[model samples]
Target chain A: MKYRNPHIPEGINVTKRHPLKELLILLGGALLLIVALSWVFAEFGGGLARLIPFEYEQALVPDALLSSDADSELDVYLTQLSERLQKHMAIPEEIAIKVHFSGDDVFNAFATLGGNVLLYRGLVEQLPHENALSMLLAHEIAHVVHRDPIVGVGRGVGIQIVLSTMLGNPDLNVLGNAGLYTQLYFNRDMERAADAAALGAVHGLYGHVGGAKALFEVIKAERDRMGDGELPAMFSSHPLDQQRLDAIEEMARDNAWAGSGAITPLPAAFADWLKTAALRTESGRNTGNTH
Target chain B: MIELGIFLALLTLGYGFGQYAERRHYRSIIEREKRLNALPAIAARFPPTEPQHHQALVIGSTVISVDYFKRFLAALRNLFGGRVTAYESLLDRARRESSLRMKQQAETLGAEMVFNVKYETASISKGRGNTIGSIEVLAYGTALIRPQAADTDR
Candidate 1:
């Protein structure tokens, strides 16, 4: 039977399609587009990073983290170390390195947009010697030299645009989180490349690879203390600590450089300062608990 | 494997229930719209003629919720950036169903036609975290009630 009204306008059937068929087609198309865009961005994003101007890159750094001339002793020390390391490396003339220290207890360092390298106090305090610290700094510096930060940010923005266009709403937080997670996973190869470059820089400056392996050994000890299970290589952005140590050992053997070198202890003054800082933090936590 | 099985189960359930609900809603809308065709709701600025009796207000409203399948589809669509056809049909049903109900109310009051009909829609919470639970549509208008014998004068 025809479901029509004589008084109503003709040819106005709104719900005409088979719902299942239309939905299946939409799902297939959406999946195809997502995979294709992800592949295209992954393949070409590195080349796009090179196109960004040095001035634009500098603009990306937040002013809050930008250190003025009146930096703290720790900040000054890190800056001097980074500068000394940069002098030995083949970094671009336009890329000026800036190191910032966060007083947080998190034992991690990361390179971000505009050649900014962030080091946590927790990581710095754990270093047994300056060379080990240099190894960590050199790794981050390598990332900045290679413009990895800009490439990461570009991939993130690209994924956000694609997702928002597909979903019909600009729910950036959800897509941004996904983009960051994917970027971290994809950076595994970059991490290895950075480690190699950092090893070279350390070798050039100190004439040995002892400090490179020593840093990973320190990290491995810390991981064991915390009882954090090892993350699978497929999921982790950095190579496993054992793998890194082994790679450094192989590189040292190939060059015939003795892996053992004079290990300079952290300066007494810095050690004293760290102890005082830790005591103050502990007291502050106790006071907070009392309140 | 277990997670994938659960996901497939949810998808199947959403597809089956969502389709059934949509088809049923469309059938109701069509039947009601046909019955109310004589009232002739139009978007014109002015009514065709003045009412013999006093004009009274009439309103109809509905809140429609989407099944889980549509929400999943919408979330996927969000990743790629495109039109959310799932929501398009939802709004269409809400608007049409509300309008038909408004006409039904007008008919009960011996009204000849509805004039200056306006629709308003708002998204309401459906107890789901962050996702839209349901959409409410309100259709309101002035009903032109005519005297018993004056209905034929048109």
Candidate 2:
């Protein structure tokens, strides 16, 4: 009797497929799933979030920096102008708009939950006229009117829950980023709507879209100075400055709205108020008032 | 962003080093298999009485850890619920390498053959929640060494 182990063939127990090839296929499929699922969740979540009462949304604002910009002359001026625009846009009286003017040099403004609007001196200081500044305020106010902040939160939470539940692993930190790309699309849509609504308010308030263009001009200049603005419109939260500029002209032509009008100058003490706001911010920071 | 960067860096390193190590290991395993083939390790309970051979137990064990690249592939496979081909080669290597080592031990004992060869496998990383883990493969058999050869070794 002969007893011998036969020479088994190599690769008999293992598949011959290439690992890298398999990875590419899996990665592509996963990306497709995440993008599709995120969009569905964004729409569903936004719809549900819209049903939330505006009065209750105020609870979501943490540590309300209302004090940071409340007492300053800048805040008073911005609030008064915002009220005038509120009447012009016919914002619901139930929705009380609270404007906070941050003295921080950050070049941005945003509306948060609870009809809270924040304006950084970095941006307001550059506005060439009151009409341009009004456009800026109106844009943020439009976000409040549209209930975008809470909807944004809902959309974000929905996507996070799905991704974490569906693709659970330590490596999720990297893969979960798939949801962010779709979220940008949602953000851009909200921004485009806000821009349209804000443009209408600017025209109604000043009877033209003239100085509104200069608002974007200031933003574009700041973007250029910061060595940015090359990001494509799709990746950006807001439409590209150039794209917004083009859209403004197109809307004006369609509505037969005048392209030129009397530009309202800001108060003569506008620059002085900005300096005072900055001093207030310095003192607040020293006192450990985080805003 | 930093976490993503680190993850990517780890993946690249795992792929590069894991592939290189696998290739070198395969080369060594194939070369040793050829040399060790003269000594057979059979999974049969019975040995021939005519050979009048003495029997002794021999065991070979190997512990192998999964590399990050292959572990990631396996994790992805868990999602799609398909063939976990990424882990197939890893287990195959552990089994074959342990068998080869067992044969080498029999050869050292001047054995004619090894009979009733059996294998055992255990995962050291059990309870660690599906991270990259180490697997242990143990091959054991009875060696049939001639009385004369056994005497000379003693």
Candidate 3:
């Protein structure tokens, strides 16, 4: 009897291809097209929006429309800080300062469009050293000097609309998708510019730049305390890698500011004041880790 | 008109899915708020003084959902190595809506300052295959009651 293998009777064995791969290929192509179109529209549409002064003016949202006062002491403190910043930065008398305190204990701070500087109370307490405060404030001031907030918001909204049109949607929720935000993350170029500006401000105010590194160390320590997953997205937003930290240190070393001992004391009564004031104005106190 | 209707139908489907994802996201935020609001206040280094004002503070938020179905579909295409086809369209929509939500809320509240803002997100649906995830967003800030006199100072 002819020994014919039953299993070998089939034609050529073809490797099975997963359906998922094909689907991904299709989806990827669609996404690429969407992105390409969005980029094109944003480039042109933004320019058009700029030319349409009436529409731009119409988009000018009033400050009164989006603010509410919380009976918190931090609000008052921000008012004072804003005034101080305005004078220190030579912010013209005409430009209004919008200061607000966040209810986080992350020892963080940021500048937003239209001269909005948000400082977390946690950062204030953690950076008991005046040099750190100066460093932090000066850093945000650098952002303001660059008018990053306005430029950033304008670009963000413009790009968002273009993408929305391609996506068949209306809004771009920066808060939801971390990846999308990452794409818009300030490039290293912007960070470098901000760093240079911040250094200038720090040298002018504190006579040193090592303080900026100290601030980063404080942030790292705070992150350590918070444990993993508890840290806010803000920490990742600006990013603080060793390279960036080293850049600041290098500037300080070059500027002869490395040995500028103790850039002013942390004030005589700050501790006592924080004890009482923190109790009255702490918003996220209950969480134990409110960042 | 028929073409317009067809386009509208597709738009509505996209919106429905989007909203479903968003609702899931919002529910998570509400849960987070409960926890955050429950936490005790911690002291900052230099706390600001409590303001004495009469004003309404408003904070707005937007939620977006990119259901599991799409993600899974993309993942399958990529051989399930977790490298899915990019969803720029979905992501872009989310970013815009969320930002707009925050802006509108701030404007509506007549707030001169909106502080202590936070963002939270969560997956509305669990598992994969036809199942979708929802993302909820919140943009909240304290509105102040600033006097008319404060406006004139500017």
Error of 2 at B79 (Å): 1.1
Selected candidate, larger TM-score, 2 vs 3: 2
Docking class of 2: medium
**Of the pair 1 and 3, which is ahead by DockQ?**
1
Worst 10 residues of 3 chain B by lDDT: B38-47
Candidate 2 lDDT over residue span A1-291, tens digit each: 887767888988899999999888887888888888888888888889998998888876755546555345666788889988887775876787888888888888989999998888888899999999999999999999998999999899878876887688764457787788688888988988988889999998889999898988998998898885458765577888898999989998999999998889999999989888888788888999877
lDDT of 2 at A216: 88
**DockQ of all predictions against the true structure, Cα-based:** 0.12, 0.61, 0.02
Q: What is the C-alpha lDDT of each candidate?
A: 0.73, 0.85, 0.51
lDDT of 2 by residue, B1-154 (tens): 5676787888899889988988888888999988888788888898888858999899999999988888888777777888888888888889989988888889989998899999999999889876648999999999999999999999
Per-residue lDDT of A11 in model 1: 23
* Full candidate order by TM-score, most accurate first: 2, 1, 3
lDDT of 3 at B100: 43
Tens-place lDDT per residue, model 3, A146-166, is 556555555556566655544
Docking quality class, candidate 1: incorrect
Models ranked on lDDT: 2, 1, 3
> For candidate 3, what is the lDDT?
0.51
Q: Can you tell me which runs of candidate 1 are displaced by over 4 Å?
A: A1-32, A42-46, A59-64, A68-76, A169-182, A221-235, A240-243, A246-257, A275-291, B1-65, B73-154
Cand. 2 Cα-lDDT:
0.85
* Candidate achieving the largest TM-score: 2
